[model samples]
Target: MDCVVTGGNVKVLAKAVHSLSRIGDELYVEPQEDGLALRSVNSSRSAYACFLFAPLFFSRYTIPSGHAFRCKMAIKSVQAVFRSLASLEKTVEKCHIELEEQKNRLTFTLHCKHGLLKTHNLSFQDSESLQAVFDKDSCANVFRLLVDAVVHFPPSQEEVTVSVSEERMWVRNHVEEEDQSKAMLTELCLASDEFDHFSVQTHNNVTFCLKELRGLLMFAESTGLPISMYFDEPGSPLVLSVTDSVLEGNFVLATLSDDTIFRSLVRTQTPPPPPDDFMNDDIDSYLIAMDTSIAPGPSASGPPTPPLADSLCQKQPAAANHRTRSYIDEKEDDLASSERPPNKKFCSLFFGSVLPPSSQMNTQLVTSQEVLASDSEDD
Candidate 1:
């Protein structure tokens, strides 16, 4: 099998290679008629990431008809060959990839500018492609938001907690932020209006890592496109996906349970917040008390979103609904000088929900009272 990648796609392939390196030392490459599939899974099994580059993404794609080609190589080997990814467009004329089945080496040749040339032989073994298979239809919540909204990640942060209610969706640092060294939790909110389609079965909240999420964000930072997020509930897999005209990518991350996070935090020196305040901002607390109704619960009655493409990529709108204005309403606060128990779990949340009109809530309550009074009199 032989394939050629030129132009900007070389850069795209480079980003894919870098992302797979995050998961494990081993990298799996599969070439189909449509495009190439790259996959990696961490040793801990906490995360799995995949990248798909459509045939159109390549300048020239070739393989035997009715057959797929795949191989496994150390991520270090792949990186060694594509060392000039950052300058591939300017430094490289074309990249020709071929499989030497007899030698068990994947030979990579870099055709460079000014008549320069380079070749690298990366050792590999015949293997099957790795695929992430999950039922998107089982996921209860799905929405789309800007990449900029999320990539504001702080250093030294581990897991990220996503808190969703009827009104809004937001994510904050999953690790306890009480330590002075670590900055206050970074929260990113997505308004109801900001989402092209936001739906949830219950007020679903889950905690996942930012590693894979950051990888995809970095890949398409130049595209400035809206990405899609879909998940079911706590202790389930979360899928973050992005789509372009000819390419798509999916990052499957396993979500940690609130209890699991709490237990882990218990083993740490950081103090845990009050239960009600756990994982949620003070505002999310106020909203939870009110009789907010008739929305966010529509997941039960709504139609199931089409499953992800070939069970990996989730197709989304090309453009999001534009808004003329924006708001930066809340700011995270520093922890108090006094620390609480080290064993209690810690969680934080952000909400950008649009509150219903006060009059509407009052009217609904009044109607319920009137119906109860009539029933009492009849009895």
Candidate 2:
């Protein structure tokens, strides 16, 4: 009979069952809030069953007829519960899960050896689930282990496979070099449709394959600097062909589409004016002049000598007249000496009488003649 108990203590029922049963016999005890029932069976049992209530809050004692076994079992159960809860908390803390809503589904097409493979319709909901799967510890560990195992035992022939899911589309790029995988992944992320609107084309329910090809080509052009490109377009299957020569002297396979062509044309054309310092023709001319002037050259204007010559010519006559006036002042002093006072002249003559008469007569005559000549020259 099934009986429902609304409010109960499980330990009280266990006590009731112990009181009703014999020491060596097996008993089945059912507990309820209102009442307790016990039935005895013909068996010798060492184990005693005890039910615990409020497992999270209160600790209940389940004493097996023996003490040691009861203690061990209780500790084990509690430890297990604690460990499980701790693990769950850690998992929740480490993860960041989010959900988004999308108005329309998005899809991608991947080129494989067998031809084009279309991906499933992807919504924002799908992205969330994909992110969660990667976040789980067990899933992440398993994925890593699988990759390690694959490296340890590589396949004989190198083959590539493409996978397309609702969230993302990727390829198993089995190149001989491991370093190339990272480059390939980077290219894929760059070429993703989320970033560039021009690279995505949706008609009806399906996304066109040419759009993905265009994205690849655009990525190559942007990142692979100074690239040589070749385009091949065939009538069948509308396949676009692209070949890119990277800056690193390596080749990348890309595809051509309308978007790719447009991007190529845009890159080929000169960029628009900068926001603040637009190209100024005047500034350019000024810079060119400065550069040209740095080198030694003949002056555009004539030599500077005519003004100096004119200044010298204007000062010559005044300098000559100043010199002539100084000479006239010197000659006047000599004439003044000849006209000294008579007493002073007689004293000088007396002093001069010591000389010979001829010398004295000659001196007087010379003096008189010099005076007459000076007067006549002045006139």
Candidate 3:
């Protein structure tokens, strides 16, 4: 595959590439018979950008139809080739790209106006294309604005809120730190015609990264086309695009959620532990000792429920062992009472974690007969 970009179109391409470079250091080039696509995503995967240039956008586009291939190169390598886009616009006659399959490299050939030619061989990596499909038709909010109006919008340093309602449409960007909620902001009360169309099926005021939106705005400002915005909800991404006769740029940014909402998600995912300092090893040992309890019959109080320390509440370590011993002794006394009904018998005080509520204890533990024999002389 081979292609060439020349004339003022190179500046537009440069602007798009520059904008995408801010999103990521790596760039993926996809060539097709129709056009070329440059795509990038930021480190945090929060921002994504794609620029597509139609065949007509370039002077000499040559891609064999049905041929398919993709390559990855550092954005810096490509940016270095057009670092002086302003001067290249005047001094460079054209730019050509050809794949050197044998060497596994992309050869960038610059044709200068004064018989000067510079060649750069940029390395590449095997990569796949990134495709994200969203339901634009079902979007809750959509709008279009004159591209140049971007310069007047927030520079992205502050919070940007896009609010739409039946009565009015306005974009407000705070120019201060987040803590300064009332700080001065740039507000544009746009009319219906101010944009190609300002329509919101459902009233919405979505807040998102102004920086990302501003980046796309600056990239497309030179195109002098309209900006198309699509968004569904607060947590979903906000989509922005600019298209002209030559190239189309699409950028998407993940929306920032309120701290409270974010915290709620975290809490839901990981439930807070109970205040009680329960240990599996302690419960295991207690379960192992239960079968050895000496019992006459049922207690008037019935089976003892675990004390707070053994229940859901946490106990201070210094008092833990002492408190647990006392609770156990009381349970043992109740089990040894003669008033206990012959049919009513329990081995130990237990909570949900210690053991199941079966009438008989686990046979694995030493039975009450052995326990009574060992302590007969002392009793």
Candidate 4:
């Protein structure tokens, strides 16, 4: 497999890689007769992303006659190669990708200006094509949102709830069951006019990860396109997509089944029941007097324990907590910190282990020789 990407399209490809890296650890590269498919699924498999770059998107495209070439490699292996998008766009003239069957390696050769070339060879393993099966046509709710819609969300926010109605749409940070009291609820409401196209057959709420949505939005924002959302019930998967004439991206994310988020929102909206008229007006004074009168002596079982608040306020010595590391060590620590714990459940079951032959997909013939790149790489 071999393909070449030239001009500003190189940045677009780099942006695609960076966006996919945000969703999963591994990148699946499939060089089909029609186009090149790049896909990724997160650690928990709760989120899956696919980007198909048509032959027209590349300067030249090529593939072997009847052989099927598909492989999976660590996303970081490829992401690092495009880490510097600015330099790639400014200095690189053409990006050539090829598969070396003899060495079983995928090479990314950057043909930079002044006859300079930077090549990256990544190892990969043969794998089946990763795909999820979902019918967007069945989705009762469909809406288009601008990429800037996420600006209202806090950077550290994880999940978000999307509530849609006939008249309006609401996007808010998800409130978990455990942290409702301490969690800050940030919500953004959009009228029908705000969306490019808003249609809601079902007035429902769906909750999904904000991180994955933001990742996809980054790509959409780069392409100067709006994101379209298709979803059904709460537990069902939510599909977000961005498409152009030559390239398309689809992200399938798992939605929370429970109504905890909705309940939290309701609780926040309604005021407490008038402080309960049953409580005597003197209750506050009584509690204050009891606090001063509590002078219990140590019992035979054990000495009196500290109050809960006092115990929680205690802190360890600063010297014991102080620490330092070298730059390399710090980088390793950062990478390790980013690792997520695996979830027992995933949306892959919805798509199954292998793609169904009847799954909805689009394919187009290559118009350029540099368009088709048969390659997969790993660290």
Candidate 5:
């Protein structure tokens, strides 16, 4: 496969390469009958980007007839070819890309003024085309905005939240609960009328990484195109695209769902243990022992429930052996009682009335047994 880019299109290709570098370290090159496809997926596989440059976009384009293949090269190698976009635009007159299957290399030839010709032969491996599956036309919400609106966001910010309502929209940096005391919060609010085009079939919020968005915006701004976003619910992929007659770009980004945010919040809200003191590991066992002495037995209609103490008491970890010895001794006294009925003693020993009622104790026992069963399954 071979193609030639000349004049202003050289800079356009450079900007496209620069934009793709931000999403992934590897660049996928595919030559098709229609155009050349350049794609990348981030390390986490959560973000994807693709740029298609039609034949019209390039001055000269050629591909072997009935011959199709895909290859991938390090993004850094491609970036090095287009490094220093300022100087590239000034000196480079034309750029040529060709694949040498025999040598297993992708060649880049630069034609510059003053009769200078420079070439780079970079090694690449055969690969399958990287395609992201996302339905853009079926999206319920669509927002069109100028790149300048988000250019002011801090470069250090990792992720941002987009919240839209009937009246307004908010774009803000996402800060963890632990960092709220010290982290800076930056937010941009725009009324519905302020957007270039706003069509909201459903009010929704989504959180996604800002780095790739910023990179794509840079390319859009250079091409004088507005960024269009299409999305449905939070967990669904967010599709951002820039399309024109000759060039088209698409970005699919994973968004954090409301359920994910809620789970994170729940984790952060859990109280921490005391820093100076270590809680006793056998405290629950002791509490159950104390409660069992006074707790009533199961209903007369039902058979006596087996005690959880048999397993709990049999295998005492070494760490808790010292602390639990006294409690075990007390339980032994109840078990040794000869005058009490066997059922009465069994009920008194396992389901004491110290803290919770018999019904509550049964529930606690069932929950503990479930946890143990789960643990065993994991093992």
Candidate 6:
């Protein structure tokens, strides 16, 4: 008898065979376009089982010539059912698969019905289109499939492990706060003077000492006062002196090298006071006039001699060792414990010779002598 199975009926027959027999027992038969002879076996087993019984089952089955059309039709129906199943399998395979292209690399991921199956990488040329896939619009479709796979198969303790890249590790180490602070401290130490009063301490168990000797030198230049500095050791004690013409100060640098010590001294002298017998305005104008007259012209070969003449003219009378005889006699008598000379020559020379010859000069001398007498009385 001839049997024809249509589309829905073919699916039902495939399911029935799948439930009834194992895959090895099933036979896959494809009939040719031309009509062929009909075949039947006397065996009690199913056709699927009988097909595998011999390596060449076509030769074993007995056929009569009149049944050719019916055999061809039955074989064709069975082949159509297997081919439909194969098509469904291929659709499932393509649905769950995903591919990605980035830069010059291509990646493929296969997500089977059971679980994630495998991943693959391939070399891709730069000019190739990344969207190229097995089917039209497959890129978008595969992207959706990848998203589904990611949602279903999340990272688990056993499946996922994270490792830091070498670049990241280097950046983290270099940008650490403590490391940056240390670098800043080093630069500040190099720029600071050795004797500055400020202190800088670091937590790295290492100390630095900066010398402020240059600061002390500048201070002396500005204030006209000498200063000296002394250091015992790095991060240790310091000393300062400010006596007479010598001024000194020192401090410790608590964050420099051990045995790194420095000391600085600024020597200075006090300026002498104006002479006791000095006449201020009178000598100043005279010295100024002398300075102007003796000033060297631009064509002169050497430095001007006016400054030297002014200095010489301004020297005190006592500096020339030319005291009056009465003053000398008084000093000698005081040394010998004897009576002094009563000569008026010393008084006349000081009171008359140095004074200008004028009525105003005489009046001024008299007033000055009276003022001197009043000062001596007050003393």
lDDT of 2 by residue, 1-379 (tens): 1121111222222222332132113232322232222322111111112222221111221222221110011222222222333233222212111111233322222222234332233331111000000011111101000111122223332222222222332323323222433433211211233311112121101012222223223333333322222112100011112222210111111111110011100011112223343222233343344334423311212221221111000011111222211011212123223211001000011111223334322211111101111011011
- Which residue pairs in candidate 5 collide? 291-352, 291-353, 292-351, 292-352, 293-352, 294-352, 294-353, 295-352, 295-353
TM-score of each model, paired residue for residue: 0.64, 0.12, 0.64, 0.70, 0.68, 0.13
- What's the CA error at residue 57 for candidate 6, in Å? 99
In candidate 4 the C-alpha lDDT for residue 364 amounts to 14
Q: Once superposed on the true structure, which residue ranges of model 2 sit more than 4 Å away at CA?
A: 1-106, 109-281, 290-379
Each prediction's total of clashing residue pairs, residues at least 3 apart in sequence or on different chains, is: 5, 0, 3, 8, 9, 16
lDDT of 1 at 3: 81
Please list the residue runs of candidate 6 whose C-alpha ends up more than 4 Å from where it truly belongs after superposition: 1-221, 224-227, 240-379
**TM-score (C-alpha) between model 2 and the true structure:** 0.12
lDDT of each residue in 291-355, candidate 6, tens digit only = 35543331232322322221211111122332221111112123113211111000111121222
Query: Least accurate stretch of 10 residues (summed lDDT) in model 4?
Result: 260-269
Q: Best candidate per lDDT, number?
A: 4
| Model 1: per-residue Cα lDDT over 1-379, one tens digit each | 5788887777778877886776667787877777777877665444667777787777777765676667777899898888866677789878888877778888888898888888998888776445544545557888776436555667456667776766687776664424635556566776777787787676666767676677777776744556788886554567777788877777777664322111111111112233453232332332232212212222333422221100111111111311211111111121112211111111111000111222111100011100111111011
lDDT of candidate model 6 versus the reference: 0.21
Better of 1 and 3 by TM-score: 1
> In model 4, where do residues sit more than 4 Å from their true spots?
259-349, 353-379
Ranking by TM-score: 4, 5, 1, 3, 6, 2
Task: Give me the displacement of residue 21 in model 5, in angstroms.
Answer: 0.4
Per-residue lDDT for 154-254 in model 3, tens only? 45343465666654666665332333445555667676666677777765555665665666877766667778898754434667888787787888765
Checking candidate 1 for backbone clashes, the offending pairs are 167-353, 266-343, 279-347, 279-348, 279-349
CA lDDT, every prediction? 0.55, 0.20, 0.56, 0.64, 0.64, 0.21
lDDT of model 6, residue 33: 28
lDDT of 4 by residue, 1-379 (tens): 8999998888888888999988988999998777889999776456789999999998898976678888898899999888787687789899999987678889999988899988999998887878765666668998887537788888888777788778788777776544656877777888999888899997676778888888888888777877999997554578999888888899988775421111000101111123543222443353344334333322221322323101000011122321221111112122123221111111221333352343221111111211111111122
- Give candidate 1's error at residue 337 in angstroms: 18
Candidate 4 global TM-score: 0.70
